[model samples]
Target: MDVAARLIGSVRLPGAAALVTGAPHGAPAGRLALRRGDRLEVYGVAELFADAPRPEAAFPAPWPGWDRGVDAVAPDGSFAVFSGQRAVRAVAADGRALWEHRHGCWGPVVGHPHTGDEQEVCGGLEHGSVHVPADGRSVWAHVVDADGPEHWVVLDARDGRETARFPLEDSAASGSHQFSLPGGGTVLLCVGMGQDGVLLYGADGAGTPDGTGPSGVRDLGEDLDRILLDVHPDRPVYLTVEHSCDDLRVHAPDGTVLAGRDAAELGEDRCWDYAAGFADADTVVAVAENGEDDGPGHWLLDAHSLAVLGPVAYPHPVTGSLRALGDGTWLTHDRATDTLSRWRRAGA
Candidate 1:
């Protein structure tokens, strides 16, 4: 009932401070997005797992105009997709713009429905960002209209063409996250920060009829403060931390609670890290803290059965979040050492 990981390979990045954006579905299998200073670099997963790891491509952060939010590197490492205040752009490796789509200004002054007071409200993309799935064919962007309705647009990665669009429920601006389904389809989950709800949108591959549409939307009851963590790599299930990390729950796209466990029931007073997600189709890897000065601990759960597989003690303390590679391995960045390391279940 114990899980163990080994240091497969590591890459030292520049800058004292850096951010690791887990590789999306469409990018090359082992590629990772490393943001240092105003620059973003794509590094090979294979290389990071090699005896000697090196970066595959490095470029300035995309969408340099305003504050940069969500972004993805193209699969072939030739281009980058970046999101701005109200636009998403595709930039070439040489820094030339390939295409751009500008939406409505994010924070528009709107009158409060009941109070009759005008206030400025913005959508999540202003701080969060879009997702680029694995096929590398299109980019999924959550865009807000000039009049205030929000829509999810799928754009062609090649030319930024609008291939499909799905209108979402009216909700205040909040961050977003997406998971790729078994096929080339994707499920986009938007977290309404102020509205206190989660919206789900689905889009089939290029050929399906009426592929992009609202799949399910739910207002998680006020008693439960939940955060969407990760999606099952191969199923229609997603993970969330409930009651501010007191418990973990597995949910279906239609808002069905598949299974869950409370911290006390797990024989510990640990708070699950909302940033954790599925390490594979049937397994979820999360971090937990027992209110001790000792660094956080890792937990492996049965994604289907909600069975706790005991705690994992890595050879080295994982300082940052855990991102599954969608393969059997995962990635962890140790800022204390400025090293990006690839990990796999020992003997996995």
Candidate 2:
């Protein structure tokens, strides 16, 4: 693939420095950008790409400890969902809490296998997340309960009421990530760490686990550093997984690897970055730190064939991974210049 990135626009944010938190996904308002320094600020895709881009809103950093550094903003930029150590809150642009739900401490108390004495433990909030589906009517929260089983709860975005819940098979999961399908009927939850697996849940109000409502679980395996990158909105049956930068595997929902390529096989100097995913239904984009120390570079692969298409040429060094916009464009952040740029096919 002979690809070139044209810098359509750029925006400098307010902060001591830029902390690129990957490419914002699941938001309708373009790509969401979160910058942290003295404080935390959230910017919508329009705010970064519009002729006159401005911050949609700003909030205090370390918002009681954001688990997994994962949060979601509504597509219209009306509200944002934030997951803290023990609670998830849907806050309006004005910083008003629309609703808040709290769970038990991330760390659960344990009793010795033989002794009855209680053992103190702590895990923090690593597997918790809050995601807003495309419809913008509901928020998907992966709440981890140290005292009991963890669950994937669907809450009304307007009122934060639990509409449905699905118990996760992996109760000791350290973190969880969610990917919403394009048309907005199903959402895939990838429970991270201990479980290292994926769960299919119905986006509708019914969150069933008895093989109903198109819900099921697939274990990727144990002791493998894997992260769920993206699920084809059009084809939820297909998804991408990044194994600790070692390789990118495109798999079925049943943990079957359809096609994959390791970084070494791609002739790269190091592992691929975690910043890779399905650019579209037919194309997958992966990035690696440039061997020449010229920042990060990307690779294009045929999604179905898993054939390497070649590298994508960027005009500037990409400090972060490439995030697909689902259209024909992708977003890249330059930390050196503190700017966010959108790129497309050379002529597209």
Candidate 3:
């Protein structure tokens, strides 16, 4: 047990509308149109002003994850979205172009069948991201080719120029899964599945296989039932929770166990069924709905160890992915609605 919560605060989206991944006004908390069905509708964040959540003046086609730009707020409040078709460009906030880069060849792993390569339809964002940071003029990106579209490349955000790139020769390293780190660097989760193996593309944009870790990937292979993958850029340990009692396991860069803990099990409340993890570089916090009645429950576990430290009651039932914004505050995204809710860890 490392730490616990004392006082907590909670808030929800005003409109009943379901949400899709849109730009989050990271600062004082503003919102944009949430994508639903075929179109986009505006939603509000925490109170931007006494009168917030106002209607967007102009609109464009809605796509999920478009605003996933690291800036928290997209330049001009718009981002490029791949709608299972072409790259649709839209704007919400004041938009600008930073540096941008695109990958050249797809590399060795194109026709590989075991890694689910065929599932990704052609002409999509196969392997590349346009990063628009806080400064509107500076954009950075990494675009890989079709053969091994998931390889990573670091480039100047303003122009689509290749600063450097790392390609995955194995079949498992696919695109569509990326983990953002604290600094400008990113960890591209390239699956080296089948014979390929799992890898982490570090800040230097190099493909480092996780299997070769000092402890070895196979050591935990059979012991693992599920792998919940999330990244905190500051922490060197890769994060995951075991299926039993949600036995927490933290692994170092070379595959050695950093920490492990088995939480005291609740009668019917078990993490093996459902648990959520949020993180930073050093720690990952997991919250589980522990009561037998299916009521909202709370528990905070050290990201490195399975140790359970704090327990609290939630205002609303907890669900979906959580984004830890430090300072005890957390952003919970509802899987069903896709809307974002901000929860402050109860303070002392």
Please identify model 2 stretches exceeding 4 Å from their true place: 15-26, 29-46, 50-52, 57-69, 107-127, 146-149, 169-171, 194-225, 252-258, 268-270, 280-282, 289-296, 316-320
The 0-to-1 C-alpha lDDT of every candidate, in the order given, reads 0.63, 0.61, 0.39
Q: Over the full model, what C-alpha lDDT does candidate 3 score relative to the true structure? A: 0.39
- Please give, for residues 1-348, the per-residue lDDT of candidate 2 as tens digits: 557767776666544133234324245444554645422355555556666666656654335433244677787777778766567777776667778887655554432122322222244545477787777777778886645678877777778777666776554666666776555555666665543543333344233222233234334544345577777636754545555567777765545677777778766576687676666667777777646756667777777876888888777555556676555556666666766676765665
Model 2 lDDT, residue 250, Cα? 70
- 203, model 2: CA deviation in Å? 7.6
* TM-score per candidate: 0.78, 0.74, 0.54
The better-scoring model by TM-score among 1 and 2 is 1
Q: For residues 1-348, could you state the per-residue lDDT of candidate 3 as single tens digits? A: 324433232334443222312222222124543443333444343431123344442234333334222222333544432222222232343333232232343333454333333223333223333333333332333344544444443433334344444454432422323333344333333232323333434342222221111111122233343243544445545555553445656665434567765544633445532344443333455655454565445556566565565554455556443545443455555556545556655553
Q: What is the overall TM-score of model 2 with all chains considered together?
A: 0.74
- Between candidates 2 and 3, name the one with more favorable TM-score: 2
